[model samples]
Target: MSIKGKVAVVTGSAQGIGRGIALRLAQDGADICLVDMQIEKLQGVAEEIRKLGRKACAFQCDVTNRSQVFEAVDYAEKELGGFDIIVNNAGICITKPLEKISEEECERIFKINVFGVLWGIQAAAAKLKANKKKGKIISARSIAGHTAWAMLGMYSSTKFAVRGLTQAAAQELAPFGINVNSYCPGIVDTNMWTEIDHGCAPEKGVATGETWKASVAGIALGRAEKPEDVAAFVSYLAGPDSDYMTGQSVLIDGGIVYN
Candidate 1:
């Protein structure tokens, strides 16, 4: 699946899954625009892409802010000469009991995970349409989006919203030749999962590593997920092989959820 000469914009690309996707796309011969709140980390990823001989730049933007996202997209397109892919990988997960999930937490999660994706799609769609270019818009979802877990009520709800928006945008953008889709990952060993493990450690009465271990035990593959696992799938979707597939949230959860 070669995406040579294409340009991709990846959000939350400072590290973890987003960083992995940015680097993978670069490796596959695509110029990349790395977007994240961490300016230093973003620059690091950008440097790596440059080392690989790809034109890359890092943009500091908060996904939750629609204007910032639009500006970032515009900047990326200008710097990269054109744009073909936008991965709305910037998201947040605040694990807590249902009773403990405050309105502020819920709204913040939606703003980042749900609204952020929406803003990306809207901004990218406009640019792709204006350029008369077909594009791919991908977002990050989760297995919890398919089946809600005990302490992740709010995060699950946000991913669920992402799934919904992906389908809706896919259908709406079809006429413009822009495909919208999402990837649902399970138990990726990223900092997000580390935070989940630590946050639920006391409430679940388990040690920090135990929560992640138990979750892995339930995986049919019996293995922990890595950021590259998710990135590989995203790379496929970003490439031309997935042009026929849209309005869908493909799961890469190690068989954690079958939907």
Candidate 2:
């Protein structure tokens, strides 16, 4: 699919799945702007995009911060000419029982996962609306968004919120030919899983990457999902081919969630 003239802004793209998606979109011909909290790593990803022979820019944006996201979005619009696509890939996760979860932790998780998506949507809404032309807004809604997890409730809360956001935004944006939707990635084999595994493992007291691999053994697919796996789906969502799809959340899990 050729996204040749489309300008794409991807958040949390400094590494892992976000990085994969950003690069994949660039490869598909979209001019790419990478957003992340880590400047150095963001630069690294930008370098890689350049190597791919695509236009690239990196913005140090903490999506949870409204001003930062807005400024970055404006800057990107200025630098890239205009906004056409937005991939709200920035988010955070925290594993804790509802009762045991501290206020600070819960707030932090919601701020990043829930509010982050909202902020991105709000900032882009005007620009996307003004175009009244074809546009794409894709957010990262995880498999956890569709189901409950024993200790992942705090994190799951945000994914569910993203789902709601996608549905609502799609309904509102469709009039302008801008599609709004989300994609759920099931138990992706990103650094996130490693951290979750080690943190949850009581065997080694703290996982040393040795026992981490077994954390996802219960998955039906027998392996964790790859970053590219999710990226492929994201590419389709951001491409012209998926114009008919809106306000939907498609899972990229390896059968992790059959429903």
* Best lDDT among the predictions, by candidate number: 1
List runs of model 1 lying over 4 Å from the truth: none
TM-score per candidate = 0.98, 0.93
* Poorly placed runs, candidate 2 (over 4 Å): 203-215
Candidate 1 structure quality by residue, lDDT tens digits, 108-167: 898999899999999999989989999999999999999999999999989989988999
Compared with the true structure, the alpha-carbon lDDT of candidate 2 equals 0.84
Per-residue accuracy of model 2 over 1-24 as CA lDDT, tens digit each: 579867899999988899999999
